[model samples]
Target: GAGVSQTPSNKVTEKGKYVELRCDPISGHTALYWYRQSLGQGPEFLIYFQGTGAADDSGLPNDRFFAVRPEGSVSTLKIQRTERGDSAVYLCASSPGTGVRSGANVLTFGAGSRLTVL
Candidate 1:
């Protein structure tokens, strides 16, 4: 894909159900990120994958949230026991990468998956 692509542009699920959001990053991008944005606030980082491994997952809220990037390109974010408080727009982004000391990072974001837990 020319840009980051996310599935289920809008998802409405009941509380306690499960949800999976998928993201297909741009070809050749080594860095992929997941973020969640609440009303009137900026996106909050959920996880960051560098290649096939998760370089950082400290932003994941709890055990109910997890993400995987098995092929280093496409990724999935799984949410279990969804709660009404979890309703938000899940954003996915991909970047060329930041080398050893490169302080610049330009990310291309997808039209986020809007999850509405009712």
Candidate 2:
């Protein structure tokens, strides 16, 4: 089966611009996640979706960041009023189900969509 897929591998925009990043998860996967990695920083969890609803969204930085998975297969992350600080590689991942294995969550990640806010 296909793995996770993200669109627009790279995006460059000026501050205050809005951007939408898309992700397509693997077939039959019920768990999906989004993470952001800033320069020199490890990827941080942004949100997690189980099916069509967001299960955990506390990681979102602010109201400017939002995500949706209306059909439980494709997800879109929407960023409003982008800023330089928001520049980073936005990664999308999916898993077979929700579980902590030996204290670590296993997931299959996309190459990522690098967003550059100038």
Candidate 3:
């Protein structure tokens, strides 16, 4: 019954460095999603995985952003060449199934991984 969790609630790095943010979804969840939120804006979808496969990754901003869920459980978001524009809260959520309307869309978000590129 563990909820989703992210490491290093806050991260600070140079503009060209790389960072890896981790997420641990709840037990028994079959769907996991990643989202990024800027100040005063809603969380934007990044990617989603269903049973170890990326169900949707269209929201990934660019080549600098990537994610993986190899075992349908834990996931990680990797950022390359970090930029100031990349500073934001990275959130992770998970649900019981893959259907958007099958109660899987009601995401229970982690506190978030706040990244700061200086």
Candidate 4:
């Protein structure tokens, strides 16, 4: 993809339902990240992947939230037994590499997927 792309720009679901959000990163990028943003708040990092391995998953709220980057290009975020509090925007970002010092890791974000719990 030319830029980061996210699927299902908006989603609405009942509390306790499961949902999956998808991301397609820019071509040849090797670092991917997932973040969550509530209304009026900055994005909160959830997970980061360097290649196929998750380099950072410390920010995930709980086991109910999970993500995977199988080929280092496309990623999926899965939420199980979603709660009303989980309603928010799911953002995906990609970088050329995972080197924090490198400008390539600065992050390019997708428009994000908005999840609504009813």
Measured against the true structure, the TM-scores of the candidates, in listed sequence, are 0.97, 0.93, 0.94, 0.95
Candidates ranked by lDDT, best first?
1, 2, 4, 3
Per-prediction CA RMSD (Å): 0.9, 1.8, 1.4, 1.2
Flag clash pairs in model 2: none
The parts of candidate 2 lying over 4 Å away from their true place are 99-105
- In TM-score terms, candidate 3 sits at 0.94
List model 3 lDDT by residue over 26-99, tens digit each. Answer: 89888899999999999999998888999899999999999998887889999999999999999999888765
Please write out the lDDT profile of model 2 over residues 1-118, one tens digit for every residue.
Answer: 4889999899999999999999999998889999999999999999999999999999999999999999999999999999999999999999887755722556999999999999
Q: Positional deviation of 10 in candidate 3, in angstroms?
A: 0.6
Better model by lDDT: candidate 2 vs candidate 4: 2
* Model 3 segments more than 4 A misplaced: 100-105
What ranking emerges by TM-score with the best candidate at the front? Answer: 1, 4, 3, 2
Q: In candidate 1, residue 70 scores what lDDT?
A: 96
TM-score of 4: 0.95
Q: lDDT winner among the candidates? A: 1
Better of 1 and 3 by TM-score: 1
Cand. 4 Cα-lDDT: 0.93
lDDT of each: 0.95, 0.94, 0.91, 0.93
- Per residue, candidate 4 scores C-alpha lDDT tens digits across 11-69 of 99999999999999999888899999999999999999989999999999999999988
Residues 47-96 of candidate 1: C-alpha lDDT, one tens digit per residue: 99999899899999999999999999999999999999999999999998
